[model samples]
Target: MSSPTPSTLRVGRRYRAKRLNGPYDAIVIGSGIGGLTAAACLSKMGKKVVVFEQHYTAGGFTHSYDRNGYEWDVGVHYIGDMGADHTMAKRLFDHVTDGELKWAPMDANYDRLFIGDRQIDLMAGPKAFVDSLKNDFPDEHQAIDSYMGYLNQVAKALPGVTLAKVLPNLLAGPFRRLANRKAPAFLNRPTQEVLEGLTGNQELIAALTGQWGDNGLVPTESSFIIHSLIARHYLYGGYYPVGGASEMAKTIIPVIQQSGGEVFTYADVKEILVEKGRAVGVLMADGETVRAPAVISNAGVYNTFGPLLADNAPHKAFYQMKLGNVQRSMASVCLYIGIQDTAENLQLPKTNFWIYPGTDHANQVDNFLKAPDEHDIPLTYISFPSAKDPSFAARYPGRATVEIVAPGPFEWYADWADKPWGKRGDDYEAKKEAYSQRLLEKLYEKMPQLRGKVDYYELSTPLSTDYFCRYSTGEIYGLDHNPERFEQDWLKPKTRIPGLYLTGQDVMTCGVVGAMVGGLLTTVAISGLKGLPLAKKMFVG
Candidate 1:
């Protein structure tokens, strides 16, 4: 890490070419949801902040782009608990801007599972979902009820789990805090360990954990807490934004700028500047250096400590050790196509379609680790963004967009990590094209009418994600949701460096809501209780 050489000057705060006037209240690296959310909260509290994003845009995984007149979300498929009150998702976005963003509710059937040969609709609301599942397994009604009981137990138990996720830094707060840590009692156990404890009917267990693919874990490897939060969240409702995913980034920029803050795209942070063991600022890719009083990062844990700030301070071996232990979530190969007709004529459902190989969650994980296949496809999460948001249809005009996503293994693109994105040579392009066609073929099996209707079709692999997000291997959702990964204590938002912080999916759990909430938590830590108006208002409201 060397001092910036002076050509790079992109900034959110006022800066002269090659010089930061002085220090800002805070500087955030990566305008990811988590980083942006924290910046927004801090700005509302009257802080002069600056957010730098290396990408051409903000929102991190949730960022969307216009391709061939069709707008599609990069990583967001569906968000949970947006329609209801009392959700952190609702409160955070609502209170931050006081309800300016518009949300498009998903179908009452949140997700439809194509397990074996049956289509199981996971209905909205707790009682509705339970009743629907009971219809599928009438013989195991009692067992199913018992399992739902445990789901209730674990669902209600997640926030209690956060105490364990946060208490490591609170060691100095109070000795009685020992009594507040409750996540550990569930940490050692995997989802399978917990689910199997509830029911012996394999089919019932499979249906209950069908959405395991969302977390990129098999029931056996996923944490019980992860399962609880996800299931409980969607048990309420799932939704998407009306304009497209980019609306999120677009809507919040005003809040940041209003308080003398800004979120910039194309501002690559190359290094974390450390002074006396505290993070003070960052050196950008264009060779400009900017300083701030404190730094918060929405970069994934591995990149933040391992590569970006590797030389900043001490605990080099410790960070490396934690790096080797933490594994990233599955990278996806999305087949996005522009179609020339309405979904009603094609009978496309607004609900997400989850296709599985068999009833075995373990086998589903195994298939995902290999690559997209005809039989298993393990999980096919499809989204009709046009149907969800009519604004998308208006832009494209008489054309509907379909995005079909399934897991893509990391090994498929090991040869192209260093190459510039989308220029992976003839062989790579041919390989991707072939895979794209296969996914299209599988998609045709489900939606036969789309056979000749595709106007544009493209596929994105793990390498593509790695190239864009700058993760080492293109793991899309940061770390995987395995039981050990969640309990690893070392992967928290606050770092050993006194002024540095972490954000995005890695800080909390994985998902749109999870990472957004993660930004909230980091903001709480940075602002403390005294500055958190939303927290006080929510608890009091």
Candidate 2:
């Protein structure tokens, strides 16, 4: 295999003290979709904002990287609700990117589930999704219909939940009460509990929650709201960015720049500077202080409250206590595979594949965590990025890429956490190779034609996530989407510290859309009455 080359996919300007465009309206920490969205929206409001990103490239998880001769996205696999112009997600994305970013639909059968020996395909469209499952389990028609109804219910109730995040505590109280009265009892319950209440068929339930890996939790642990949000978000089908995942930051950065704002890469914020109980600015790792009236943190909650905030920062103790309420989401290992052939020639499908050991998702996860080597791999999600992206063939001709992701506990690689990125020692390399081969075997089991066709591949563990994304525990999703996580009203955009605010997946749920909504709410919170028009345009339209 050939050695890797320096990626030409870098986005955002590199950080430099001389590059500072000071006296900015707002300063955003982290360039994840949430931060970028907030900054872009603020820019539209005529507010000059500056975004700081610690990574070599911006877009947080949305960024894509190239190696040897292949490119792969880190987080964005597929997004739904992009097929039409009416969806809130679509409108928000359009507003931020000024309609520059485009999307391409995946196959009608967007997701394929391999549960034990059974093969199930989640077809696009509400009717097709229901019919596809009904066709497999002919007797569970009512259960499937009820499940779809619940997803619709969650969709309707979601706006109220969003409203509570942006509205003041006093004003949001009534809305919360009204929403609770109107929402179904199972809306915030455990996913498995809600599905079990609807049906007793284990296979059917397993099939309904087959996409559990999308939220990084099993049905028994994750909230019904998150499950329904994910299920409903992709109800139509999955869509990929026209170019690639990096197109997100690539498109949005221009909007920020248009307003005389900038997104800087390699901009490490050492601490969020506080003064007189208000967020004043950020102290950079280079010891330079950049001040803005408002500070928005797109970094996850743990990072925001833990290391970013000084120990004596106002309300830091309260946030530290609140942090104990939620848990970090699961981490994973992804194997990026490169093949020296066109996706068409390789016969790669655009549909994502979810492989599971059996119908009992919770137990499988538990068993695997107990003895990763001995038990069957709980879940393996495979995505064909080269096949999904239309521009991939033209960008890197005669090359295709495949990514396989599976649950990898942080503890599995904790010993190597203190080590550097590329020099984690031979033991770490051996362990990663073992996991890579196992994951490759799973791919071969599904597509035997590509066994020897693979030209190169590399495995990235939780340690890599820490090294690049600064997620200490290597969690992909900011926080666990368990039932308790949803009940925490404190996880909103506004913070007790006057000028400080929060955004990203921690503020809402996980996924690209969820984090973007978090950014939208943060903008609304900061703009107050001035943002009412923007909020209406995004949520109401």
Candidate 3:
């Protein structure tokens, strides 16, 4: 490994035991988009909130790092529903960031899917998207129209479903039942099943479900509800934060500080302090305890229930049983590449690429998992960050960056779990090198013009995710987006424990906007009547 390249890209204030201001109304664990949103919203409500992030930077998955004279974002690649100011995503972002953060729109052709040897482009706008699909599959025009209609149906039913998560128990039960009745029968069915019923053409189904990796699940295994949500989200085209993903926390932290709140980094939380079956505060790893009236966990379900909470608590057994029902989402490896030339010079497009071995996504994934070393890589997603963000040229002149992501299970790197990051033995290094070479080969296959133009590259494995983000299994998207996973009534924002709440992707779905919605839902759940006005602005008016 090369000498440590220091990251001058710090966001939140460094945490110390003495720096903690006391008598906070709420303590939020983790500074992911969800936690930050909740903290900012509660701050607007005149409540003092403190957010703790175990990583060196805030924004969790949305964080960016500077290394080897280049910068790369961890999770945020492209977000949808940002082009219009009336969108919920834009409204929520403006509310939290105080309208300081801006968005840059991507190309009209936002996504290109290469399944086996065939290619399909998903364009922006409903007419463009339908026209592109119709042009490719002229015989399946009816199916494409039906697919768009179904997405609209999901959009209509989403508000009721999202509202149920924060509603009181008595109101929520009937609301869920009503939502189920009003929703399409194929809402929770598998994506493949629903799409196949609409059109018998397998190629059309494959093209439509090409973005399956966005949710970390194949079509046959994932819920149609999640697929509809993701498809409708990008229908209007994809947008990146104008300044980069780190601007998420950069803009929201001021809102938190306005109400005497702070987001602290390097703040390792040891456990939640529970007294009389209610969470009162958190015990930091530094042997200091910070007390608050309410404690919200955006760390994820497994982390919250497995390590943070006590074992002998009344709800421990119940949560453990609930955990058994749902499995972790897919872990991944990302190859971050740096180029010395500018994005314009490199001719990189402001579009994402989703490559698949074949149209049978589920089968390909199964075969690869059965024998990872022998089978072909199931999916490879490549993003050009420098091309997407308009402000990249000013931040790092004469430079560009690319990110390639693919599935990598935790078991592949379990032996190196105990080793410190960047100091793993030669064996781990060799394994990473092998995967990195394969991913680069995929990139070269698509754009072979610059075969040897790469300046620097590094591959981050599942262990890297665990070490940095505190995900025990290196799961990226929190829990899986299977049909059964969404059926859990306990996955809502409000926990049974008195002063405890849940937020982030685990509470809702997965994505920057999904997690932020979870944060908003949590604030509503906690504030009750006080949050109704804000909720009315965001949801009703």
TM-score of each: 0.91, 0.99, 0.98
Error of 3 at 342 (Å): 0.9
lDDT of 1: 0.73
lDDT of 2 by residue, 1-541 (tens): 3433545789999999999987899999999999999999999999999999999999999999988888999999999999999999999999999999999999999999999999999999988988888899999988888888888889888888888998898988888899989988898999999999989999999998999999998999999999999999999999999889999999999999888999999999999999999999999999999999999999999999999999999999999999999999999999999999999999999999999989999899999999888998999999999999999988888899999999998999999999988999999999999999999999999999998999999999999999888899899998999989988889999999999999999999899999999999999999999999999999889
* Shift of residue 249 alpha carbon in model 1, Å: 0.3
Using TM-score as the measure, name the better of candidate 1 and candidate 2.
Answer: 2
What's the ranking of the predictions by TM-score, best on top? Answer: 2, 3, 1
Candidate 3 Cα deviation (angstroms), residue 511:
0.2
Worst 10 residues of 3 by lDDT: 1-10
Q: Please list the C-alpha lDDT of all candidates, in the order they appear.
A: 0.73, 0.94, 0.92
lDDT of 3 by residue, 1-541 (tens): 2322545567899999889987899999999999999999999999999999999999999999978878899999999999988888899999999999999999999999998899999999999999999999999989999998888888888888888899999999999999999988888899999999999999999999999989999899999989999998999999999878999999999999999999999999999999998999999999999999899999999989889988986697899999999999999999999998899988899999999988889889999999988989999999999999998888888888999999999999999889888899999989989999999999999988547999999998889889889888889999999999988989998998889999999988999999998999999999999888888888765
Total backbone collisions for each predicted model: 1, 0, 0
Candidate 3 achieves a global lDDT of 0.92
Model 1 Cα displacement at 93 (Å)? Answer: 1.5
Write candidate 1's Cα lDDT for 1-541 as tens digits: 1222222212233333344434578898887778888888878878877888777667777787666655567877778878876766788877555478788887899788878887788999888987898898788777777766766666555554444344446662452244335334554478887767767877777788878867877788888878877887788767888777777777777888777777777777888888787788888877888888788888887778767775636665678778888787777788878776766666777788777767786776675565544345667767777777756555556667788887777787787766787677988888789878877876787778778878888888888777667876767778888867765666666678777877668887888777776776676666655545655454334
